[model samples]
Target chain A: MEKTIGNKTVNVSEDGYLIDLNEWDKDVATAIAQEEGITLADDHWKVIEYLQNQHKNDVPLTIRSVGKSGVVDIKGFYALFPEGPLKKASRISGIPKPVSCI
Target chain B: MTKNIVILGAGTAGTMMSNHLRRALDKDWKITIIDQRTEHHYQPGYLFVPFGVYGPEDIVKPIEKFIPDGVNLKLGAIDKIYPEKDKVVMVSGEEFDYDILIVATGTDIAPEETEGMMGPHWQKDVFDFYTLEGSSALAKKFRDWEGGKLVINIVEMPIKCPVAPLEFAFLANAFFEQKGMRDKVDIVFATPMSGAFTKPKATEKLDYLLNEKNIEIVPDFNVMAVDGEAKTIMDYGGKEVSYDVLVTVPTNKGSDLMERSRIGDELNYIPTDRATLQTKVKENIFAIGDATNIPASKAGSVAHFEGEVLLENVLNYIQGKDLKEGFDGHANCFIETGHGKALLIDFNYTHEPVSGTFPFPGVGPLNLLKESRMNHMGKMAFKWIYWNMLITGRHLPFVTTKMQEAGKNFD
Candidate 1:
């Protein structure tokens, strides 16, 4: 299935993940974590929510501010989502309009 | 029939190659250059545009003005390269046959490749100095701006003129100091690399300069996305850095034609023999400048040196002789550290940047790995050399194609 994040359309495997209560459930989280190589934490959920909401609201995020926010370390975040959130989260969230991430 | 030589993308490498080859080839040999634009930019001047040191009028000139007479300059977008046939097809459906092809089609910024980089805040709070337009726009923004938090970020590696963002940060410090706004602004440098530079010695020097300038160094910070509304840059680690003004060095990639041709590596850079400058896909085709996937610094000096070696090989190829592997991957760059002082570094693939006397060993002139006023003057004087000599295929008096070991302190 595909969903829209920011201006991008991302594909989610039908068997992979499911969104639950503003957070990705265990199965979906595990799939996202394995796929993105990130250890998703509760604070990271806040980041995910913020990114998703920013996409929905058309707000943009800077990498510097993201690093300073202290939700996660810069290296850890890069390891989990090497391609960055707009690409990875959009795919996991099943967002449409993938080019919007650009 | 005269042999046809087609050069794609009339940038630094393309222009230099055309000038070099035109002098070597007889009148009977046809040399055609294909490019999309009529204006040729002195790319290094883009860094100064944001600081008002170089105006738009200074950087651009007509492509025809620089290209020699008798060489056909075709202004059009290249569609694809048919290496199997030794031809380049243009977007306008015109195909030109060539005996040999030179791919000098340099790189482009893919700000769009990064999420939210080209979004609402683009050119407003988030600016890139890599482009002529972006740099000029930033100058205006810098002029009227009361600084809060100015963050200089490099999104990825392999960007053109790797020291440019650092130069911008340094220049920004000088700019703010001149304007008496240095106390008002907090400058931070965020890079994807483990340190300030790719080389360890250069990194040590740059780290010291960063600390000296009070520019906080946040290394290994991989950019995730930009929250323009929130004014924050988030890393995957959930670390966020907030900025009042975001100066970003976006991701750079080779020409889209590489993607269309399906012959490039992961980043769309053509794989080539590092020493030969010959494309791995075809013997008749060669890659130069920022286009090749060579593990060397992508500076104008690298192209200038590569041009020398490649030209020799090209002539050898025409005579049906074995091409010599002469390119040493030599690159020399002037690092501007603000305050009317700069550092010079000369190195190749194997050697890290070292400190010693340059050109003349232990005698006089430019000092390597040390900031000096003379190096800064040399850096400033290079613009005249570039336009009058370098691009015209004239050999620089003090500079050579190969790196000399005599002047460097290896120990």
Candidate 2:
């Protein structure tokens, strides 16, 4: 499915994660973050950049890893994204949601 | 010159690979599997231990029982792997060189990662069911449990058998019902996931099950610490959920060997090619199951599914052929919805679990994503299959390494 975020249209999943990261940009991220009641600040972008960088390297994301990434602590991560930090960060970063399906 | 195919961990994935490759490799090519643990446990049975559906005797067996005759089973702690040197160093000061290395070093619960988890009430009111000792201890604790607020909390994601906690909640409901104390117990399932199940359609169905069983779902709760003295789990967001007895699935990580070797990720899981099961560490090195940072579920079934792809990849690596991107992350699991019923979910990397017929297209032996007695039977029957067929590297009849989408209702 395609969703219009800010001035750009991008593919998204039913859960609203960006289907293709190539279509992601700052405007799109701000638009997605806006839906979650989060305004992208410098710290949020740092987390988003960290998440995108991790996704690029194929390292599976987790709150524990994000906390240990030296980008932010767990409490700081929650404070940045509020609730569901990993999912929110992934969404704004335009990466697949980090999940364990067993 | 004699060559070696060294395997780490004699658990499900390692043992199965050892059996699968031993007969195929030439006599000159030696296969040695190493693990510190002596017993091979049927890990799925751990979910039933706390409920007494299965006993300690049922799930455990000697590791030596599964190793094929030609393969050598080295029982010792592996200190590190020098991938560049093609060597494995044991903690006891012994070293073994290998032509190829297979790391099936499965994950384990790290309760100490969470503050106060291993504190004063370690195995008393606060318990973990991932380990044999944990499950057995939990069973003993449940013997005279009068039932109050029983919270089953998962501290983090990527835990082994992702659905086991939900199964625990469902079984707890059934357990209390059988004891004629269902109403006396308030069941709470606290997880980091957004819902009872991760998949959408499955969540829709499972959410109904949770409601029907009266199990409370507490989503988006990431544990910062276990307040053992207060009997509460404190999330990073400052959400506190109190419990009379808490069964938590703590942070799970790859083998310590990976940590010692400095070849693993932050969680000590080896970064691997998701499709090929080949590790990023080295060309000759491959990782499978819970040990690798594959997005797939860290369950025996995932390892079982990956075995076919990984086996082919190893053979390919030996033959100097290009590796096939054959693995599709196929995972099949039975969700115990309690009342002697369960839901069987069959899915892959690209597909979510949908309602359909399994093994057979339209003919009805087992149903997917729908609760049935047959699915529960399939789950129970899996134990025998695990012991007899799975560990022996034989394929189950009608099941394929890749998921069959013919009978499934997609959309």
Candidate 3:
């Protein structure tokens, strides 16, 4: 499936995650954040930015790593991404889903 | 030089192993995973089916969808495993040679093992949620249930998703309350265990949940049989618990092929080195998930954690290197306590679940052994993660293959 993020159309999986990493950008992320009902604050951006860096490097992004990244603690990360911290944060960061989350 | 790696049963453990090994091993290693089923059933979601919280569509997906690229998915029933030859034969008489074999056949519920459990009352008043069909039938039964005695029992231990029966009772309590029929339903939880759960600290919290919801816990009640005609479950001591609805978790056993191969123990589970997951019969053959006689919870999370350790050991075996004894039996579960609240517990072989903040000590967004709405949401969100992440062999960020005790409170 595909979702229109701003003026760009990006491929999304059945779960609404970015299928192609190349199609992701700030505009698409902003659009995804809006769709998820999260207003991307600076704290949210910290987690998102850290996730995007890790995704770019092809490293797995776990909640603990995000907490250890000095960007945010586990509680603050959850506060930034309410329901599913790793999932929601990864989605907003436009990365492939990390499997170890639960 | 091509080498073959054959994995039996492409369910939770099998699927994850395929993905993990595919990425970790060299291109010379050819991985083939075999399973009889085309569809992959998310076993944990079976608990919610009875309460209508999740439907059939929510829990199932194609096994091929999760099978990683560069891996072969062989769909067939196994005939036998010849450990001496390091080869597996299918029921169709086809044979495949392997340099290494991973038995991840997992376990199945055997309700027929108990007397009268699957009698005429089954799918009418008695049901088992461990299977898809039983769970679906219970859903319809719960829809029109006027409510009387609702008894949830465990016929035996070492069942898949061990906490599912308790989760059902908690959800039943919430389901009834949502329908305004809570007063009419008399919920009783019958278990062979001494408490509401196995772990002491976690059990303390779960006992409180059962008490707070007015659900009775009949612990140490060894079920002998079920009088289906009379709608009562009989214990060994001849005590009977009457029920309008009987939900049971039957005796779980490994594949019949395990017995056919003669490498299995009395219960048909392959005897394995607990730390290395290598079968006692053959160093070339290993077992993971519910297939091994490892003293680990038969939960998906355990399989995911085991996948990490197994991948490392498999590579070491291929390279003629020493296998690492790193598997700590790390297992964790999110317990649903109903009314939009849930509790999370993390533990391993040596550590019982304790009260503390998870991942980041004192900075947890999730509390251990404490009910919270976030935990419930995490439980719900797991279905998504199970499908997208875990099966794809993605390394979870902060979680380790072994249990960590830095933030845990034993005091």
Q: Choose the strongest candidate by DockQ.
A: 2
Model 2 misplaced regions, further than 4 Å: A7-10, A100-102
- When 1 and 2 are scored with TM-score, the better candidate is 2
Note the residue pairs that clash in candidate 2. none
Query: What is each candidate's fraction of native interface contacts (fnat)?
Result: 0.21, 0.67, 0.00
Clashing pairs in 3: A62-B397, A99-B389, A99-B390
lDDT of 1 by residue, B204-297 (tens): 9889999999999887677779889899898655678999999999888899999898888656788888888988889899889999988787
lDDT of 3 by residue, B36-85 (tens): 99999998898889888889899888889999899999998999999999
Best to worst by DockQ, what's the order?
2, 1, 3
Alpha-carbon shift of residue B271 in model 2 (angstroms): 0.9
Interface root mean square deviation per prediction = 11.0, 2.1, 16.4
TM-score of chain B, per candidate?
0.98, 0.99, 0.98
Best-matching candidate per TM-score: 2
TM-score of each: 0.81, 0.97, 0.79
Poorest 10 consecutive residues of model 1 chain B by lDDT? Answer: B231-240
lDDT of 2 by residue, B1-411 (tens): 788999999999999999999878888899999999999999999989988889988899999999999999999999999998999999998999999999999999999889999977988998999988999999998889888999999888788988888899999999999989999899999988888877888888988899889999998888888888889889988899999999989999888888789999888899999999999999999998899998888888889989999989999999999999999989999999888899999988889999999889997599999999999999999999999999888988999999898999997
TM-score for the B chain of model 1:
0.98
